[model samples]
Target: MKGISILGATGSIGTQTLDVVRNSNDDFKLIGVTANSSVDKMKEIIKEFNPKYIGMMDADSAIKIKEFCLENNFKVQVYSGMEGLIKISTLDEIDIVVTSVVGMIGLKPTIAAIEAKKDIALANKETLVVAGELVMRKAREEGVRILPVDSEHGAIFQALQGNEIKDLKKIILTASGGPFRGKSKDFIKNVTLEEALNHPNWSMGSKITIDSATLMNKGLEVIEAHWLFDCNYESIQVLVHPQSIIHSMVEYRDASIIAQIGSPDMRLPIQYALNYPKRKEKVAKEIDFYEITSLTFEKPDIDTFKCLRLAFDAGKKGGLMPTVLNGANEVAVSLFLNKKIKFLDIADIIEDAMTIFEEYTHNDITIDNIIELDEKVRKYVINKKG
Candidate 1:
């Protein structure tokens, strides 16, 4: 059985990961878990999983869970904040660390985990988007396996099972077109937060749902795929597939295309990452093609969703530019979620931040450099006028 630690055990991906572990039937053990301010959810997880280590981003929540564990006679170590995250991530007992946290918060612990020689099941795209070079290098040095847990990246990974990377042509990432797939700029500008959060195919966290509405999520994935696959930005392609059945595709130089098609469930990818190089009994439901009518595709309307265009631009520029883009988008999405800015303003803010930090495009990508730039971009976005 493989030992596992989930860094964000209360989030959507984290909870689903817990489900995978729970049903693994002695194939896996939950060694540690962390969460941000989800005291109730954390308590429930502690009761069930009884992981050896627990980390809470919120100190008070950590205290509460600790007290509950003590009263319940559960022998578990509870910690708080980044320090806690790192400790749990690098625990010697865990063979693999699942970096499933949202935003840039997942980067540090993921790096720490790699340094500790732990394999990574990466669901956090921002970790790669912000510091792909450094993270991938560390993984290589540690001889660690960085598994892709995102559906698109997972699909590409599956399709390339027996194929050689040298024969690869490009990767095709599928997007759900969100709720405003064909809507004009005018329509999107006036779209309410509720509408943006109302995704057609996937049930995700609010932040990601908003990113999907803006198409920035797919753009971020493009940057991530570049790092994970060791492919250039020019070789990555994004298509609008409303059905989401085709999670993603990879094409070879021989003009042959391989695809991983499945229902839009995150568990399949999560379980696949956990049990790498091996296929187990399925957790997600099988796709019934007889009931399905048709699968369709279109070119992503980058003109309408400027965030996607900005992501490609930032990714192509390389270096710390993608860091600036991700930092700005996190703050921008938060602003939109709070009803403080129009949905369109997100791209404007990210683009402006990217332009402001363009001179640092070729700078060295240290963890310190990325964190400093991220802080600067967040402050800039928070203070900028819409």
Candidate 2:
């Protein structure tokens, strides 16, 4: 059984990853888990998985876990803060680290996992969005397998199983278009947080749900696909597929399109990543073709959802620009989530930050550089909002 560590055990992807582990039939062992202040959920994971190590991004939560473990005689080690996260990620027993944590916070721990020679089941897009080159290079150097856990990237990985990179044409990422697919800017302007969070197809955390509503999730995925598949920005395409039956597709050089189709479930991708090079029993619900429906597609409304456009621009610009884009977006989304800004302002904030940092250049793409840039961008966004 392969030992596994989940870096965000309390989030949407993290819990789904746990389901994958739970159903692995002793093929995998849960070794370590980490979360950000979800003490109640973390308690449940500890009782069920009995992982050897636990990390809480929130210090008070870690103290609480320690107390709970002490009272219950759980005999598990608990750590706190970023150091704790890194420690869990690099545990000696963990052969694979499933990084489902959101935002730039995921970058450092993922790098630590790669450096520790642990194969990565990557669900965090911002890790790549901010430091794709560095992380990918580290994985290559350590001979670590950085598997894609996102549904779209997982589909692309599956479709390219037997194909050579040279035979590949372009990657097609499908977006469900969130809660406001066909709505105009006028309709989106006054949209409440609840309305934006009400995703039509997939259920996710607030940040990503907002990103989806703004079409920025697809944009981030575009950048992620570029890094994962080593494809050019121009070669990546996003189509609005409302049904979400097709997670994603890849077009070959000969114009043959291979699509990975299934129900809009995150578990499928999680299972795929966990069992790389092997296909286990199905853990996700299968799609029913008997319904006899049509799968339609449309171009993403980039003009209305300017975050998507900004992501593309940042990705193409390269260097620290994508870092700025992600960091700023994280802050903007947080502001919107807190009802401090309008939903449409997310793209505007990100764009303004990008514009401010456009001429910025970095000598090296180190973790320090990425983290510093991320901090700077976040501060800039908050100050601008203020």
Summing lDDT over every window of 10 consecutive residues in candidate 1, give the lowest-scoring window.
377-386
Could you give candidate 2's per-residue lDDT for residues 104-223 as a string of tens digits?
889889988899999999999999988899988888999999999999999999999999999999899999989999999999899999999999999899999999999999999999
**In order, how many clashes per candidate?**
0, 0
Candidate 1, overall lDDT? 0.93
Residue lDDT tens for model 1, 240-327? 9999999999999999999999989999999999998998888899999999999999998999999999999998888899999999
Displacement of residue 332 (Cα, Å) in model 1 is 0.3
Q: Could you tell me the TM-score of candidate 1?
A: 0.99
Task: Name the runs in model 2 displaced over 4 angstroms.
Answer: none
lDDT of 2 at 340: 97
| RMSD, every candidate, angstroms | 0.9, 0.9
